[model samples]
Target chain A: DVKVTQSSRYLVKRTGEKVFLECVQDMDHENMFWYRQDPGLGLRLIYFSYDVKMKEKGDIPEGYSVSREKKERFSLILESASTNQTSMYLCASSLSWGDLEQYFGPGTRLTVT
Target chain B: EDKVVQSPLSLVVHEGDTVTLNCSYEVTNFRSLLWYKQEKKAPTFLFMLTSSGIEKKSGRLSSILDKKELFSILNITATQTGDSAIYLCAVESAGAQKLVFGQGTRLTINP
Candidate 1:
C-alpha cells in the first residue's frame, strides 16, 4: 500500500513563530500537494509541486511557501504563524499530472496560540 | 472562481437505512470528480468519475457523476455506525493539478 507520512500529528506554536510541516511519500509520485482544511470553507489548496524543485502557488498560498528538495519529500513552511493560520494541514501526492486521485497523508493539526 | 458545493451539511440515519449525498461543482475545464470518506484521521479515496452516466459501486457504496449537470451523488445502503464519516467531493480542473473540495457532508449513523 502507498503511504504518505506527515512529520507531526499535532503541533502548537506561538502566533509569531516560524513553523514547518513535513510530508514524505513512499511511492515515487511526481506530483505533491499541500492543503489547509477548515470547517466551513472545506479544503483549500495552498501549494503543489510537479517535479523536484518546481513549486507552484495555489489559491491560498498567500501566507505559505513550499519546498520539494527531494522527489519523495515535500515541506510546507509558514514564515510566521498566525491565529488564523491554525488549521488541519494535509499532504497529498499523485503519479501524474492529469491523474486526479491523490494519496493523502494523515494530516497535521496545527494550533497557533 | 472554481467552486464545489455539497448538500445536506449533515445527515442522521439508522443502521438499516439508506442514504444519498450530493455534490455539485463549477469549475473551468472540468477533468474529473472524486469522492472521499474522512473519518477521524485522513480521508480515504472512494470513487473517481470521469465520464457521465456510468455508476461505480463498492459493496454498500455507489456513486455516479453527471457531467452536463456538473454534479455527482453517492449512495450508501445498509448504513452502519462504522460508515459514519465526513463525505467529501472534489473536482480536478484542467488549469491546475489541484483538487477543489466541497465543505463535505457529515453523516452519522445510529445503532
Candidate 2:
C-alpha cells in the first residue's frame, strides 16, 4: 500500500513565527499537493509539484510557498504565521499522467496564536 | 472559475437507514469527479467517476455520475455509525491538474 507521511501531526506556533510542514511519500509518486482545510471551506489547493524542482501555484497559494528539492519529499512554508493561518494541513501524492486518485497523509493540525 | 457544490450540508439519520448525497459541478473541459470520506483527520479516497451512468460501488456505498447534467450522487444503504463523517466532492478540469473541492457534507449516523 502507498503511504504518505507528514512531519507533524499537531503543531502550535505564535504569530510572526515561521512554520514549515513536511511531507514524504514512499511510493515515489511524481505529483504532490498541499491543501488547507477550514470549516465551511473544505479543502482548497495551495500548491502542487509535478516533479522535482518544479512547482505550480494552486487556487489559494497566497502567503504560502512550496519546495520540491527531491522526488520523495515536498515542503510547505508559511512565511509568517498568523491566527487566520491556523488550520488542518493535508499532503497528498499520486502518479503523474494516470492514476489521479491521490493518497493523503495523516494531516497536521496547526494552531497559531 | 471552476466550482463544485454539495447539497444538504448536514444530515443525521438512524442506523440502517439509507441516505443519498448530492454533488454538482461547473468546470470547463471537464475531466472527472471524485468522492472522498473524511473523518477527524485526512480524507480518504472513495470513488472516481469519469463516465456517466457507470455506478461504482464498495459494499454499502455506491456512486454514479451524469456528464450531461454535470452532477453526481452517492448513495449509502444500511448506514452504520462508522459511516459518520464528512463526504467531499471534487472535480478535475482540463489544463488544471489540481481538483476543485466543494464544502463537504457532514453525515451523522446514530445508533
Candidate 3:
C-alpha cells in the first residue's frame, strides 16, 4: 500500500512566525505536490516538485516555498505566517509527473493567530 | 488559466437514491480528469478518466468522460450514508505536473 504521512495533523503559530509542513511518501514516487484547502475555494496548488531540487510554482505560490532535498520527503515553508495563511495543507505523491493519479496525505490544519 | 467547474455545489438526498455529479473543464493541452472523495481527512482517489465514452466502475460508483465535450459525470446508485462526502474534480494539462481542482460538491445522504 502507498503511504503518505505529514509531520503534523494540527498546528498553531503566531503572526510573523516561521512554519514548516513536512510530507513523506513510501511509494518512491517521482512527483510531489503541496495544496491548501479553504472553504468555498476547494484545493489550490501551492507548489510541486518533480525531482530532487526541482521545484515549480503552482497557481497560488505567494508567501510559500517548498524544498525537496530527498526523494521521499517534501517540505512546505511559510516564510512568515499570517492570520490569513491559516488553512488545511495537503500533500500528494504520484508515480510519474505525467500521471494524474495521486495519493494524498492526511491534511494539516494550521491556525495562524 | 485552466479552469474546472462542478455543478450543484451541494446536494441532499436519502439513502437508496441515485445521483450524478458533473464536472466540466476548460483547459489547454488537456490530458486527463480525476475524481476524489474527501471526508474529514485527506481526499481519496475514486476514478481517472482519460478517454471518451469509456466507463470506469467501482461497486456502486461509476464514471464516464466525454473528452469531446470536455466534461465528465460520476454516478452513484443506491447511495448510502457512507457515500456522503465532498466530491472533487480535477484536470491535468500536458506538461503540468499538478492538478487544478474545482470547488467540490458536498453531498449528504440521510437514512
Candidate 4:
C-alpha cells in the first residue's frame, strides 16, 4: 500500500498570513501534486513536482508556491493567505508520469479569517 | 486546455439498485483514464483504463473505457450504502505527470 501524509488535517489562519502545508509520501514516487477542492469546482491543480527542485505551475497556481527539496517531501506555501484561500487541500503521489494512478493524502481543510 | 466532464452531477438511489457513472474527456495526447471513489476524506483509486473495450471489475464495481469515443463508464451493481460517495474521473495525458479531473458525480444510496 502507498501512503501520502499531509502535515495538518485542519488549519486556521488570519488573512495576509503566511501558511505552509507539508506532504510526504512513503512510496518513493517521482511525481507529487497539490490540489484544492471546492464545491461545484471539483479539484483543481495548484502545483506539481516531478523531481527534486523541479516544479511546474498547474491550472491555478496564483498566490501559491511549492518546494521539493527531497524526493519524499513536497510542501505548498501560501505566500499571503486570504479568506478566499480557505479550502480543502490535497496531496498526491504517483510512481511515474506514465503511471496513471495517484494516491492522495487525507487532505487538509484550511480556514482563513 | 484539457477538459474532463461527468454527467448527472448528483444521483440518489436505493440499495440493491444499479447505476452507471459517465465520464467524457477532450484531452490532447490522451494516455489513460482513471476512476476514483471519494468519501469525506481523500479519493481512493478504483480503476484505470488504458485500452478501449476492456473492462475492469472489482466486486460490484466495474468500469470500461472507450478511447475512440474519448469516454468511460463506471457501473456499480447491487449498490449499498457504502457505495455512496463522490465518483471522480480523471484523464492522464501522454508525457504529462498530472491528472486532469472531472467535477465528479455525487452518489447517495439509501436503504
Candidate 5:
C-alpha cells in the first residue's frame, strides 16, 4: 500500500504568519498534489509537482506555493496566513501524471487566527 | 470550463436501505471518472471508471458510468452506518494533469 504522511495533523497560527506543511510518500511516486478541502467545496487543487523541483499552480494557488526538493517529499508553504486560510489541507501522491488513483495523506487541519 | 456536478447534496437513510448517488460531468478530452469516500479527513479511493456500460463493484458498493450521458451512478446496497460519509466524484481530462471534483454527496446511514 502507498502511505502518504503529513508533518502535522493539526496546526494553529496567527495572521500574517508563514506556515509550512510537509508531505512524504513511501512509494516514491513521481506526482504529488496539495489541495484545500473546504465545506461544500470539496477538494480544490492548490499546487502539484510532477517531478523534483518542478511545480505547477492549480485552480486555487493564491497565497500558496510548493516545493519538491526530493522525489519522496513535497511541501506546501503559505506566504502569509489569514483567518480565511483555516481549512483542512490534503496531500496526495500518484505513480505518474495520468495515474488516476491518488493516495492521500491523513490531512492537516490548519487554523489561522 | 470542466465541471463536475453531483446531485442530492445530502441524504439520510436507515441501515439496510439502498441508495443511489448521481454524478454528472462536462469535460473535454475525458479520461476517467473516479469515486471517493471521505469521512472527516482526506478522501479515500473507491472506484474508477474509464469505460462506459461496465460496472465496478466492491462488497456493497457498485458504480457504473455512461459516456453517452456524461454521467455516473454509485449504488450502495444494504447500507451500514460505516457507509455514512461524503461521496465525491471526480473527472480526469486528457492533457489536464488534475482532476475536477464535484461538491460531493453527504450520505448518512442511521442504525
Candidate 6:
C-alpha cells in the first residue's frame, strides 16, 4: 500500500499572499506531480518533478511553481496567490515514468479571497 | 497534443442496474489507459489497460481497452449506491511522465 499525504486539507489566504502546499510519499517513487481540479475542467497538470531538483511545467503552470529538494517531498508554491487561484490541489506520485499507476493524496482545497 | 475525452458527462442509475462509461483518446505515442474512481477525496486507482481486448475485472467493475479505435469502456454490474462517483479516464503517452486525464463521467446510483 502506498501512502501520499498532504500538508493541509483546506487553506484560506488573502489576495496577493504567498501559499505553499506540501506533499510527501512513502513509496520512494521517482515521479511526483501537482494538479488542480475544477468542475468541467478535470485535472490539469500544474507541475511535475522527475527527480530531486528536476522540475517540468505541465499544461497549466502559470501562477505556480514547485520545489523538489528531496525525493520523498514535493512542494507547490504560489508566489502571490489570487482569487482565481482557488482550487482543489492534488498531489500524486508514481514509481517511474513507465509505471502508470499514480497514487494520489487527499486534495487541499485552497480558497484565495 | 494528447487529449482524453469521456462521454455521457453524467448518468443516473438505480441499484442492481448495469452502467457503462466510455472514454476516447487521441494521443501521440500511446502507452496505456487507466481508470480511476473519485469520490469527495482523492481519486483511487481502478484498472490499467495496456493491451486491446483484454478485460480487466475487479468484482463488479471491469474495463477493456481498444487500441485500434483509441478508446476504452468501463462497465459496472449490479451497481450499488456506494458505486456513485466520478469515473476518470487517463492516458499515458510514451516518453512522458504525466498522464493526460479526461473530464470524467459523474455517476449517480440511487438505492
Per-residue error at A83 for model 6, in Å? 1.4
User: DockQ of candidates 1 onward, in order?
Assistant: 0.85, 0.78, 0.85, 0.81, 0.78, 0.82
For each of the candidates, the C-alpha root-mean-square deviation to the true structure, in angstroms, is 0.8, 0.8, 0.8, 0.9, 0.8, 0.8
For candidate 4, give the docking quality class from DockQ.
high
Model 4 achieves a DockQ score of: 0.81
Clashes of each: 0, 0, 0, 0, 0, 0
Q: Write the residue-wise lDDT of candidate 3 on A21-104 in tens digits.
A: 999999999999999999888999999999999999989999999999999999999999999999999999999867779999
Error of 3 at A65 (Å): 0.8
Q: What's the DockQ of model 1?
A: 0.85
Candidate 6 pairs with clashing backbones = none
Please write out the lDDT profile of model 5 over residues A1-113, one tens digit for every residue. Answer: 89999999999999999999999999979999998988788789999999999999999999999999999999999999999999999999999977979999999999999
Residue-by-residue lDDT tens digits, candidate 5, B1-111: 999999889999999999999999999999999999998777899999999999999999999999999999999999999999999999999989788899999999999
Where does the lowest 10-residue lDDT sum fall in candidate 2 chain B?
Answer: B91-100
Better of 5 and 6 by lDDT: 6
For candidate 6, what is the TM-score?
0.98
lDDT of 4 at B51: 92
Q: Please give the CA lDDT of all the candidate structures.
A: 0.94, 0.95, 0.95, 0.95, 0.95, 0.95
Superposed Cα deviation of residue B47, candidate 3 (Å): 0.8
* Better-scoring candidate (DockQ), 1 or 6: 1
How accurate locally is residue B16 in candidate 4, as Cα lDDT from 0 to 100? 97
Colliding pairs, model 3: none
The Cα error of candidate 6 at residue A5, in Å, is: 0.5
lDDT of 2 by residue, B60-93 (tens): 9999999999999999999999999999999999
